[model samples]
Target: MRLEQQPLSQVPEKAYHLPAGTAAAHGYDLEVTPESAGWGYSGLRVVTLAAAEEHAFSTGDDEVVVVPLSGAVSVEADGSHLDLAGRADVFAGPTDFAYLPPGTTATLLSERGGRFALCTARTDRHLPVRYGAAADVPVELRGAGRSSRQVRNFGTPDHLDAGAIIACEVITPDGNWSSYPAHKHDEASATESELEEIYYFEIAAGPQGQPGLGFFRTSSSPGHPIEITEEVHDRDVVLVPFGWHGPAVAAPGHAMYYLNVMAGPPHPAAEAQGGRAWLISDHPDQTWIRSTWADEQVDPRLTGERS
Candidate 1:
C-alpha cells in the first residue's frame, strides 16, 4: 500500500477508496486513522481473525465500539468480560456490540473466524464500557419505493450512551437508493453541525456468489473544496471531511452495506450532558423528495428479519 501526502487542491476521490489490502497491519484488513484521514476525529479498523485467534489494544484517547461484521466473539474490557452473540454477516441482521471507554484496554477472541469493525473517535471523556444487545437495536426502514433502506441504529446518538461519537449501519437493498436528496452538515448552527464522516462499504454477492457494484457521490459545499462520484465495491471507503453527500445507490442483483462513522466538535458546556445529535441541511433542489416518501410504501426487503 502506498502512503503519500496529497495536496488539498486535488479531488478527494484520488485519496479515498482504500482497497482491501491497501491499509492492512497488525492483523487488521483495513485501518483508517484521524491523521490519515486529514481530519480531527473519526477512525475505523476492520480486523479478521481465524478461529481461536486473539487481538487486543488500548483505546488510549479514543473511545471505540467493537462490532462484529460476522460470527461471535468474546470481549474483555476494563476488568469485565462480555460474550457477544454476533450474526452470520452484516445482511443477517443486527449484531451485539461492545463499547470501550477512552483509555481502556480490551481483548477480543473469536472462537469462530469472523470479521469485526472497530469504530472509533477521539474524545477526552472516559465513559464506562457497555454492551448492546441485538434485540435492543432499532431496525428502521427508511425512505420509500426505490429510495428505501434499512438502518440499524445500534450506535446512533439518540440510542446509545456515548460521548463525542455517533455511529450507525445502513443496508441498501438491490437497486435502491440511500442517503438520498443530498445533504450537508458543514456549518455550525441551529440547523447544521460541522462533522467528519467515514463510509466503509461492503457489497453483497448475488445468489450464485457473483460480485456486485454500487455508486457514491459527494459534492463540494459552499466554501468547502471536495467533489467525488465513484464506483464502489466491497471494503472500499469514502471519507467526508466536508461536503454535500448522498444518493448511495446499489446496483441491481446486489445489496449494499455501509458502516457510517461520524463525530464532530463537542458541544459548548454540554460535555457532561451525555447527549448526542447530528444536524443536516438538505440540498434545496432535491429536498422536495422528502414529501414523496409519505405516500409510498417502504421496500419489502426491509422486513427486519434476523438470519
Candidate 2:
C-alpha cells in the first residue's frame, strides 16, 4: 500500500511540539515524515488497530522497526513472518520487535485492539529483515533518587543490525527526572556523534483512568539554536535536530514513557578508537548534579517486570 504523503511545511507552527492526532495519516494516529521534521534522517509513525484488524504499508526509501506498545502483533515482510510477544504496556518491561528493510512491504495484524510504533529512518542502504526477542533486551537503570529511569536498549548499535537507526525506550517514575544535565549530540567529533532524535511520549493514566501530564524541554546549543518547553501528554512528539535536551520530568501523579528514535552518519573511526555508542556532551553548568546520585537510591517503582 502506498502512503498518503504530506508536505513538510504544512506541519504546525510549533515545530517541536506535536499534539496527539495532529499528524495523523491513513491508518496511523501519529505520522511524522523526514520532511515534516525538516531533518534528513529520523521519523516515526504510530498506529492503533481494532480487534482482528490489519494494516499494510511499504517502507519505501526508509527502514522501520515494528514495536508493539500495548499488545501483540505479527509482522510480515519479504515473505518472512515474525510473531511478537508484546507486553501489556510500556511499564511492563520489554517487548519483542521486528525490523523491516527499505523497499519492503509489510503488514501488521492484531487479534485484539492494540497500538504499535514504527520507528523509521531514511536510508539508501538495504539491510536484512529480522526479529528481536525481548529476552535479549538490556535493561539499564540510570541515575539515582528522583533522577532515576529505566532504559530498554532493544535497538541500539550493539543490540541490532540497523543500518543508521538507533532506537530505545525510557521509563521515568512519578515525580522523577530523566535525561538530566541537558545533553547534546549535534556536533560531529570524536567526543560527540551528530544525530537527529525523535521523542514520542506516553504519560501513564491515574488509578481512575484520569489523564496524565509531563514536561519536556530543549534549549539552544552553542551555535545551534532551538528552544522548546512544553507540557506533554499522551502521544505528544518532540523533534531535536540540534540542541541541548533534557529533564523530561514526569509529574508527581504519573509515570512517563518515551520512545526515542535516533539516526545519523556512523563514525567507524570513533568506534574503533572508543566504542560504537550514542555519545553526548552534557551541559557544563549542571554536570555536577550527576554526583548527587551517589547519595540517593533508585525509585522503588522501577520494578522491571512484565505481565
Candidate 3:
C-alpha cells in the first residue's frame, strides 16, 4: 500500500506556530510542531532554541535525538558533561548528537545558543539515550567490495538483533556519497536483522553560498515515485514510506547532512508472521558505498540571513 508522503518543497514555508504562553518569561526556547504523516504513530519535527534562552531540555515517553544544526551548546547526561562549542574548528569536527533513551533525563544549556533540531520517536520502541563523541569514539569501516566506511554503531560494535530502534548521524563530506548502494533490513530473520526507516535531512549551503540539495528516487512500482528536488536548506525533510531509498544524494557544492530515525514491527510482535520485511525493489546504477577515505570535510559557511 502506498503511504501518504510529504515533500519539503511542496510544503509551504510556514513559520513555527508555538502555542501562546508556551514561551516562559525567562530564557525559554519555543518548540515547533513536528507535523508529518508517514510512519505510523511515530512523531518527527524540529525544535529550535533561542540564544537568550537557556532551557533545561528533557524527554518523556519517547526516544529523542538532540542535534545542533548550527551554533554552540552544552549537553549533559548521566553525570557527564560534553561541550559542543568550536567542534568544527577541531578538524572539521561535527556538532554532537545526543540520543536520549526512554526514562533518561538531561539538561541543555546554550551559552551562545542558536537553534537545535530534536527528532523524537513515539512508540513502544525504547532507545536508551547514547552520547557518542566523534572525536573520542573509534569509527569502524564497514561495507566491503566497493562499499566501505565507518559507522558509529553505538558504543558497542554489534549488529542489532532485537529489531530495536536506532538513531544514527553521519557526516558525508563534500562530493562524497553515504548510504552508498541500495540495501534494506525490513526482515526480522534470526539474530541478524529486522527494521523500517525514516530519513530526516538537515543541510547547510554548499561552498560559495551554493544551496545544498539531496537526491532520492523511489522504486518504480504501483505505489508511487517519491522524489526530492527541493534544494533543501536547514530544517527540511522528505518522508519515505515504501520503496528502495538510496544515495542520500549530495551535490558538489555542499556537504549534505541527515539523521536516520528507524523503528519497525519486530518478529516477536508479529507472532503469526514468519519474518518482518517490507523492502521494495531498487533501480539499476544505484550501487556503491566506499573504498577511498576521500578528501577533508570543509565546513558549510552559514550565510544568507540566519533564520
> By TM-score, highest first, what's the ranking?
1, 2, 3
lDDT of 1 by residue, 155-232 (tens): 877688787788999999999999998998877877787677999999999888888899999888898777789898
**TM-score for candidate 1:** 0.93
Which parts of model 3 have CA positions greater than 4 angstroms off? 1-35, 41-43, 56-58, 75-86, 89-91, 94-97, 103-107, 123-131, 136-163, 190-194, 204-206, 220-234, 267-307
Q: Please, what are the lDDT tens digits per residue for candidate 3 over residues 1-307?
A: 1223345324332211112234223332323222334343234444445664565645565556666656666777667666655243211444466666655567777766566655565444454445545455434443332233234433221322112345555555455555666554433444323344555555557557665665544342234333433344444554444345566656666665665655444445343332232333334455422223244322233211110
Where model 2 places Cα greater than 4 Å from the true spot, the runs are 1-13, 268-277, 304-307
Clashing pairs for model 1 are: none
Residue pairs clashing, model 2: none
Candidate 2 weakest ten by summed lDDT? 1-10
Of models 1 and 3, which has the larger TM-score?
Answer: 1
Provide TM-scores for the models: 0.93, 0.92, 0.60
> What lDDT does model 2 reach?
0.85
